[model samples]
Target: SLVKTGTGELTLSGDNTYSGGTTISDGTLIAASVNALGSGDIDNSGVLKVGEGELKNTLFGSGSLVKTGTGVLTLSGDNTYSGGTTISDGTL
Candidate 1:
């Protein structure tokens, strides 16, 4: 499992394959690639930023998702996150 905390930004850019899931308790987690978050469940209690790619993870939490940067950030999965999503600067 991956747990992101603190008050900074974390960027995920690799085509990850971890199935243990992800948990964001604070700060921001930027998905910089299509498969950056891998295929797992996401529990975000902070900020989830999608820069320019596609995310296919199942999200569920009480945080917020912000779309930033240029290009398109496509959400192409069964996302169950009970958080607010905002388009800050770019296309979501």
Candidate 2:
């Protein structure tokens, strides 16, 4: 199951499961860090902004994954991209 908390923070604890596609629109997800714990495939279609954390596993983005602050974007597996990525004004 998927769980969401208040606007202060959102956390998905424990081993989560998904049979179909999961979509998260305009929002912020703050865990101890951002961990994509799965051996399956992750198809990112929207804008995903990672704050301060590590992004484990493959991240397939159709849109973009913007990172602000002193955060790190970590990919443990393979990442497939169908769209383009741009870094402007020292921003990524």
Candidate 3:
């Protein structure tokens, strides 16, 4: 599993294939590539920023999500995050 901590922003731009999932404990995690987040669940306790990608993972946590850029982010499955989601410039 991958745990994203601290402040600022982190961008994933490669074709990741880790199945253990991802945990965003703080700051922002940005998916710069299509399959940057891999193919697992995402437990976000911070902020998840997306530009263009398809998320088939189950997103669950107490963090917020932001969709930016000028692309489409396809989210599949039920999201149970307690925080809020804001689309400032992109399509979710």
lDDT of 3 by residue, 24-74 (tens): 999999887458887778899999887777777889999998887888988
Distance from true location, Cα of 68 in model 3, Å: 1.5
Worst 10 residues of 2 by lDDT: 1-10
Q: Write the per-residue lDDT of candidate 1 for residues 1-92, one digit (tens) a residue.
A: 78999999988877778778899999999887656777678899999887777677778899898887877888887877788999978787
Candidate 1: 10-residue stretch with minimal lDDT? 31-40
Taking every candidate in turn, the Cα RMSD to the unseen true structure, in Å, is 1.7, 5.9, 1.3
In order of appearance, the predictions have TM-scores of 0.82, 0.47, 0.89
Clashing pairs in 3: none
Q: Cα miss at 89, model 1 (Å)?
A: 2.8
The lDDT values for all models are 0.83, 0.44, 0.84
> What lDDT does model 2 reach?
0.44
Q: Which scores higher on lDDT, 1 or 2?
A: 1
Model 1 / residue 81 / CA error / Å = 2.0
Q: RMSD, model 2, all Cα superposed?
A: 5.9
Compared with the true structure, the alpha-carbon lDDT of candidate 3 equals 0.84
* Candidate that beats the other on TM-score, 1 or 2, i.e. the better one: 1
